[model samples]
Target: MRRLPMSLLRVLWVATAMFASGSALAASCAWPDWDHFRQNTVSADGRVIDASTPEQVTVSEGQAYALFFALVANDRATFDRLLNWTQNNLAQGDLTQHLPAWHWGRREAKPGDTTPSWGVLDSNPASDADIWIAYTLLEAGRLWHERSYTALGTVLARSIVAKETAMLPGLGRTVLPGPVGFHPQDDAWRLNPSYVPLQVMHHLASALPEQPEWKAMLDSSAKLVTGTAPHGYSPDWVIYRSGKGFGPDEATKAESAYNAIRVYLWAGMLAADAPGRAAALDAFRPLADFVAAHGFPPERVDTQTGTPGSNAGNAGFSVAVAPYLAALGRSDLAQAQVQRSRSLATQSPLGYYSQVLVLFGLGYLDGLYRFDADGAVVPAWTSTCPAPR
Candidate 1:
């Protein structure tokens, strides 16, 4: 465990004291970006809302990211608030017992109902969100010295191993995107590269040595990233058959877009000694090169032909690749992308997805936090600075 600095201790108090008023977080200097997100995207009740949708949907992905960001900010009050709301509303009041539903928001009442209701819009749970939430809880527990958080995280991780994974014909155990609907045929199982972050897998293995499944997944997840991105560009979705191995998913036409973007982000933030770091960096070099040649990233790429589409990516895409470029020692390009991202943000307000990407990309570039060799979170706020010269 690390000691919190006096400056950050003040920020924590500000965060907790303003729990009812929801005002002080905006004024904290620990992380200005986090302050903006806490004020804008997260609701007073702790739900992270994608305000663009008609239903104003609340995805488990958003909630999970918020938990992580709060932890990085050393704002335990917000983290617990977010966790409590997720358990009570999305997980049927017991996150350890049930995987939180991936989708929740305003819902129109069924036939004979008096008015539209707000509840679980979809019962299916997203595995990415589950993994992130479990990881966040485990880290929070260790950092805060809270046994309850650790116990809950352990159960959630075990539940994930039990319910969200499947044994492939030759690949051993691999994580599915969700519990259902991914296996469309007898031989085929659909998977998302973004869903299996190797860094996260590494931490899980170290943290839960008893769960051998986490250890095996390190290779399987690495294969998913390298195998699917045959042209050095990851696809949003891919399929693995009993004998055929990895193939493009027709459902998504094998496009590399929003979902695939995350994978590069995950790989970029990997610790130098983390498993599969070298291969992951090499496999996705083409995307980074494209950004280097051009000023921005491609909005879409044909994963098969290595051909980038005509449209350029949004501000989020540019910023999201900052870590990737920095990882490759392209400091010049990294700074350029971050500058472009900020300029774009000034032109127009960023939406939820762009907002989160900026947080992840900019946060890492700014030294707010990093993942260690053991896959544990190393937030900047946890440690004090050196004595002034």
Candidate 2:
């Protein structure tokens, strides 16, 4: 049965490859920095979202690669364009084997390519890319009422979640395969245990709650992530199946802060609504505090010495702190964190992560929803956990 599905998926991939050929189009606008971007495009508030003309810029193949900007700036038009582009381009590949990794340029690049590669499926699927793209596509579908995107997005999310989890052998977090699995660059035969999927699962649960299986997956994911952490310092990398810990790797450890922050913050947020919210929140608090003090996290930590080791820069990590702070109801702290992150990001020229942080920070600052000064949820999105009226 698995083989049959894979074969069918492969055929679909080949068929889609026909249209996948091409370099990326330019972004319609010139968002040199967050400030300039905000001035020209986004209003201080949430109601007025603007997009730079497509003539101004072109997005890459990956859903999130460009969609990040769209989401942060709250530019529905550009976001829609990028999402459509992802559905049309990246989502064309094999449903079973090598999924669509997004391409960054006119020529869709895969991981390890000189240029920024399409984040779509690479030789093998990277869990983060798969989940992020799926999440974004679903959001796009909901925002735009695009049935095709919604359907495809749901399929993508399900396919990746099922395929990857099935390959694993026990009750554990879904780790990115080290060898020919998801990200081959890191460990050849290990699981790149990451926190990104937790976020993905949360979104999935909310997006597709009717499906008992989806809910089960989310429950499984929450258990695995929150359960596996040692004092909430969830090691960035874990050897596959064997359950051995592998710290961060060279490919993108500097971004550890960026990724880890999501795990902690999302875990904390979800715990407030999860049935086992108390324990999860307890675990996340320590990790969050550690990050706040360290300023950075390593891809691989010296377990013996408890020291940090990572290869990426401060850009990714810095940008992540703001949201985490805000989520914890420390808006003042969140703003402070955002300022520091923005400063570090600015020093690194133009990168997607920093741009995203600035835009999202601005969004939070603008009081997009009904968040208070402390970033508390006065009456935000309702959780499965009941809130007092």
Candidate 3:
């Protein structure tokens, strides 16, 4: 047992210190849950399948969400795979030229086909999913310094404005659910409040200032979210008449259910300094109070009557409302919801949609990312790994 030379000892010490620093850096940037989500829900070819259905359909929404989660996790490989699969399978091989079809996967093609076929089930584009994809690509471009991502995001954003939005008589320019079917009548158009998250619009406006419609969309969305929910709850869909303004969509019976739940989640996740933060919170205050009183969100609510169905919201709902509750300064209530979410996640695993809500809500609450005043993403990575000059 001989003592090492002084120079050798100093070199070993430096190497050990460097190793520790590198390990810490890696840990700080890791997002293991996202990896788990990819393993469980996404396929090798990048299709995100919702296994709850027997048909195992892959939706544009699923792909969009995976892309966002991948970006957040800083997994460029997964991000590229997800984007490529979406463009090839859903958007006819080019995202810039085509809005990805909403639904694709296995389904019976004809009345008597023995073997089910795999392809695009519906050619319609869901604006919500489209926005998320575009936002992720744009932010990825900025964060990762990838010109290709930025270019694709710019084209997709412009395409969304062109195809998915329309000029409502009194509402100004508004985002329709898609390019078609939303406007069943000449003077009336259907809109989904959940389809346009204010934060996403803000990001788009900041990313694409030349596109005036993005700012108009932000203004109109704030009006719609606050004006439509007279009873402090958002409806899944609503109709706007040329002169009448906002009203419940007859088809949905004014129910605030799955789609509407995201309204509170998005409102809560907004940066404290984000534009219209105060008004958006004020508009959604009743929901915060409801969760505080009830210990969980209602599975369904009558938007006109403020009456909630008996069933309690699942873990996903608890997670979605947690950020909103915290935003309203009810940290205790928010913590309660967080605990409830943990318990629920333990009892039953989250499905695709619930997982998305949890990721958005809890990620913000955990300080993973924040939207700036202008709506661009401020990811944790910026602090960990600054861009090159």
lDDT (C-alpha, whole model) for all candidates: 0.88, 0.46, 0.85
Ranking the candidates on TM-score from highest down gives 1, 3, 2
Stronger candidate by lDDT (1 vs 3): 1
Give the TM-score of each candidate: 0.91, 0.59, 0.90
Model 2, span 309-374: residue lDDT tens: 554335545444455555566666656655666676567653444454444444434433222222
Task: Report how far off residue 158 is in candidate 3 (Å).
Answer: 1.2
Scored against the true structure, residue 32 in model 1 reaches a CA lDDT of 80
Q: How does candidate 3 fare on TM-score? A: 0.90
Error of 1 at 4 (Å): 25
Judge candidate 3 against the unseen true structure and give its global Cα lDDT, from 0 to 1. Answer: 0.85
Q: Which candidate, 1 or 3, would have the higher TM-score against the true structure?
A: 1
Write out the backbone clash pairs for model 1. none
Error of 2 at 84 (Å): 4.0
Q: Which is the better candidate, 1 or 2, if ranked by lDDT?
A: 1
Off-target runs (Cα >4 Å) in candidate 2 are 1-62, 68-74, 87-98, 102-122, 172-189, 192-199, 209-212, 240-261, 268-281, 284-305, 309-315, 329-332, 345-350, 357-366, 369-389
Lowest lDDT block of 10, candidate 2: 21-30
